[model samples]
Target: MFKGLKPIQYAGREVWPLIEGGKGVSATNHASSGAWAAAGGIGTVSAVNADSYDEDGNVIPQVYEGRTRTDRHQELIDYAIEGAVAQVERAHEIAGGKGAININVLWEMGGAEAVLQGVLERTKGKVAGVTCGAGMPYRLSEIAKQYGVYYLPIVSSGRAFRALWKRAYHKVPELLGAVVYEDPWLAGGHNGLSNAEDPTKPEDPFPRVKQLREMMRKEGISDDIPIVMAGGVWFLRDWNDWIDNDDLGKIAFQYGTRPLLTKESPIPDIWKDELTKIEEGDVLLHKFSPTGFYSSAVKNPFLRSLQGRSERQIPFSTEKAGEHTHQLDVGVKGKNFWVAAGDLLRAREWDGQGFTTALKTPDNTLVFVTPEERAMIRKDQADCMGCLSHCAFSSWKDHDNYSTGRLADPRSFCIQKSLQNIAHGADPHENLMFAGHAAYNFKTDPFYSNGFVPSVKELVDRILTGD
Candidate 1:
């Protein structure tokens, strides 16, 4: 049904209107990317920990081996680059005779430039463009030009677009293909939600897209440069009014969560079922991340556990200034419960529930709960393969020193280990599951069969035809 659509010029290549948003970990892979490209549009393959595995699913050799954080990060860079190149080659092969293929990069991730260079140098002319987000990719234009590929920056506002254009647009003018406007409130993964933009106030995207288009034109950016709309994009009918409009003449739609249901998507069936049964308030945007940014995810047992921990925590002062700080003797052998009067009741409640295990971190801070839960946490830590550059749970970092300076926060977990587990069909109740708010629609949408599976073509066609 996407017939008769005019070709949009992107990085010297004519591409279709569809652009698939990149999802990390194995969610958005070469198969799904190739399928999207096969539809004559731009398909983005995620490169987060790209060098994570080889064709046979084996780990590559460490590129660096030093105690320092910089050294460790450097090694990670080399591995990621090699992995990205492999993924790109696979995607290129699958694209076959289809349209252009693009790579998605997370600027916040360690070794961003090295990984990009690795993919570009290896792929050479095979890749058409690179899309970067998670941070303000100030040097993206420079990198894209060096590799001779188009660049697309995912932005949330017109002001952000203007700022990037003024800083780096001149050097890579020809390479600026499109601007992805991801709705901070509606999208999954790391959100761009600002302090002022309340989650309660859901803004219509059409007006925002129009504003960005006008801002682009003011900055001498041509009208031909498409503004790709992402987040909460379920069906074409939801965006019918935004499409083919004068203000947003050349527009494209990017799908992040909806693509997970497709056959080409790499997520397991168990995770897909969770998305189907999710309710309206089941998806939450929380500020618990140590990155100091908001993230969206399902309110499953994993998330609820964290929420409960936050609620039960109390401030303790060394001075004898508070009424709550009291040394209390415990019946358990060789254990003392340092409880505030307020926390005393909570501790008693846990004790009545038969929770006897109390674990302490390196800082000597205690978290008293159930032994069974602690064992699960310990198992999750043991299974960690050091996916993220630094993890609070395992205290694993690219360097000997804390890279993000957040190794002690109980609020943070090893994202890599948890995501990998969930993606591999591990216990959904324990592992964190990232999803868009529109995930709940899976239950009502006829496009999904039994809330479990749908072919890539079917999902894409449903999006294009608004079914």
Candidate 2:
């Protein structure tokens, strides 16, 4: 049972210590988030390219009609604002003025500030707070204050929180509702892994969260403010000690993966069905995102293809030096292309296998792909609508001529395309499926035996029982 756990005051209201973690690309939508809110928990709506519906309740396809990158970017922002507004309105109606609903956005997403402002302007009292991460969102507090809503910053470690608090969060201390400590290595989708931390070794979150509490106390922040512990959270029984621990005051749990199978979830039936079949170790943390941040997803055929591409890569030089005396079999700039003798043989072998096209990454590395793959990559890059603030894949920057002045990296793929396709009922195995590490629990959990899918209220009720 959820003993000694009480409702925490958040967004000027009392709500359960359960938060529905925001999943992007319409994974969490009006139906899912609204039900979560009505269930007395905080419902988080994903503002990253949210979806809007037509008069008949059909999804409005996000088709870009602009011929240029700049033109398409404006279209993207307009679509984002429209979609967020619709989602918030529906969620508010379903909530019946109970619980709280928060909108989440990534700081690195293109037109983030504009989209947030526009959505909030239209949403008005519907939204309770804003949860932002994926970068140091120093402006989140100030912006949320302008809209008269609370602001929550998602961070990994205490040092990161300290830096943000000192920089800008200090001035708006009253508006800072809560701080989320997302385990970078364990969380799904884009994470906040820093250079000091090793991804292969995940440190225990207990000590890290305790350090954050100490930092908060020293800063004169109230112990009443909740610390949302996200990542790898499946069962409350596993975290019994954390519920009422003095070291970490007012703790809450955020679930990013478990909610995908609920009846109200907006994802396609195929996606929900696949969640019940996941096994331990099926989730993989990799660095294939165009945002240049580490992300976790199911190890599907789509990810396996990227892994194979990177594995076949080899370093090359412009001029012959040392063991690089062999002539390159592929012509790019000229015969000036130089590689080690062994690499030349490998390149030839790859070419014979029809992986003939060579593409250069910004890191001065070459990855070989088939002609079809090369054409697809070029087409995706050309169709960029500035979806990210600074994309490493397409080099589409949201500022100044809309270019990052670097060659598009072939190692990264366009996230917008893959996520949108999956959410729209594409083959789950061929798309990037963001999932938490504990997603495998769905397969073994008795609550989901025989492919039983519960309503949002039933799920929340079950969670309160410490199942």
For each candidate, the alpha-carbon lDDT, in order, equals 0.73, 0.91
What is the lDDT, from 0 to 100, of the residue 59 in candidate 2? 89
Ten-residue segment with the worst summed lDDT in candidate 2? 329-338
**Best of the candidates, lDDT:** 2
Q: Model 2: how far is 429 from its true place, Å?
A: 1.0
- TM-score for each of the candidates: 0.85, 0.98
The alpha-carbon root-mean-square deviation between model 2 and the true structure, to one decimal in Å, is 1.1
Q: What TM-score does candidate 2 get on C-alpha atoms?
A: 0.98
